[model samples]
Target: MHQVYVLKRPHVDEFLRRMGELFECVLFTASLSKYADPVADLLDKWGAFRARLFRESCVFHRGNYVKDLSRLGRDMNKLVIVDNSPASYIFHPDNAVPIASWFDDMSDRELLDLLPFFERLSKEDDIYTMLQEHKSS
Candidate 1:
């Protein structure tokens, strides 16, 4: 593969830093590790992620790569996935905290804006109910 440039989303470093302090973070993506790992290494300078899951970790279902949260051996109730792709969490939508995809918008504050919501989530005992309420509002 050729060399590629990965742009960091605005405030992503801060977001990951704060989230790491609050929760046992995991970097899960549909991307292959060969590409995603290096980018993650660059982005996660603070060692935010406890684990990094790549494409092989996902299940190919209905033409989409679905992240099987059940396979993680973690408590489902405490797990929350913050992803821009809904297909990634098709198996466990209730645990998802939907985020918009970032592009070249340097002015975007989506990641920074989600900190408060995630902070509130860190205190919650039931993720399903909180995420459902979050989706509704």
Candidate 2:
């Protein structure tokens, strides 16, 4: 048997709780369901994710597993993806909020810092416009 230990990101619970309240949050990952689902279940205690999408949901392009967000059947203008890997959202960079990948940095507050921005984002009509403005600023 193989046991794995997962560390929750700082303020991730708060982040998920708040994001759940404001948006129809979905857990989308390129990892296989067998691995990611259990971790998500452990991390998401508040039932934050309305849906969970696994590796099969991704589109493999140029040797990378790209999350083709258009397949999600949602309004593109309202869609937003928060991910650490740029390649994951290469197909829809306009809708993505690129985050730095986490790995054993206990002092990291990226998720916490994003709360206010996400709160503001929840009110915007066009996510692309807001993201573009955020990128420029």
Candidate 3:
């Protein structure tokens, strides 16, 4: 058995709260349920997330965990995935925003920094087009 240190990203609480206000927030991670659940419960103490998906939800693609947003039971046109790695969203690149990976970096503000952009996206009728524009910019 191995122990893992689950570090909550900085400003994650505020970020999740803000996201919850604008969208139906969901927690999707490649971590195992045993590992990710407690961390998520702690981070989402205010119940920001509407749903949760764990490692089983991801596909083992080419030695990597790939998160296909199409499986979320929601309309793909309205979905955007904020992942730390672009590889995770290779299945649907147009709906991806590659945030910087945070490995216990207290100074990292990637999630917080994205508030303005995400806020704009919240107003967009089609998240796919906005994500595409973001990728090209």
Candidate 4:
């Protein structure tokens, strides 16, 4: 493949579809747009993400890239970020839902494991408080 190619994580489309039904999903990554945009298209061909943010949105802090969710123009209490990298959500630990890094794990069901919680979480009055109480890292 001379062109860059991306493989969709197993069941990720279903996961995104499920999450999309509950909340306004957003794609926030530290990857440069040139690379990330195409990957995003493949990952979200169903158009699950309500917004997409790229590397410019990241903050270079302490030699690690940090995603500042505060700039998302939304209430911090109602926001959640699921990422494999701790550095991505270091600025808002309470809002982070950590996942083990996956590489060619075709049988992975990490996304499925999260569905029930998100289903319940969408109804909560405050996500931040709920996340603190649940704290699954």
Predicted candidate 3 versus true structure: per-residue lDDT over 9-118, tens digit per residue:
89998898899888998888888999888788888867888999998999999998988888998888888888888778889888778887778789988888889999
Write down the lDDT of every candidate, Cα atoms only. Answer: 0.92, 0.92, 0.85, 0.87
> Residue-wise lDDT of candidate 2 within 3-59, one digit each (tens)?
668998888999999999999999999999989988999999999999999999999
lDDT for each residue of candidate 4 in 1-137, tens digit (9 for 90 to 100): 33887776787888999988899888999999888888888788678899999989999999888999999999888889999999999999888988888889899998888888888899999787667766744
State every prediction's TM-score relative to the real structure.
Answer: 0.96, 0.96, 0.89, 0.92
Model 4 regions lying over 4 Å from their true place: none
Error in Å for residue 131 of model 2:
0.5
lDDT of 3: 0.85
Q: Model 1: residues >4 Å from true position, as ranges?
A: none
Model 2 C-alpha lDDT versus the unseen true structure: 0.92
What are the root-mean-square deviations of the candidates from the true structure over C-alphas?
A: 1.0, 0.9, 1.9, 1.8
| Winner by TM-score between candidate 3 and candidate 2 | 2
Candidate 3 collision pairs: none
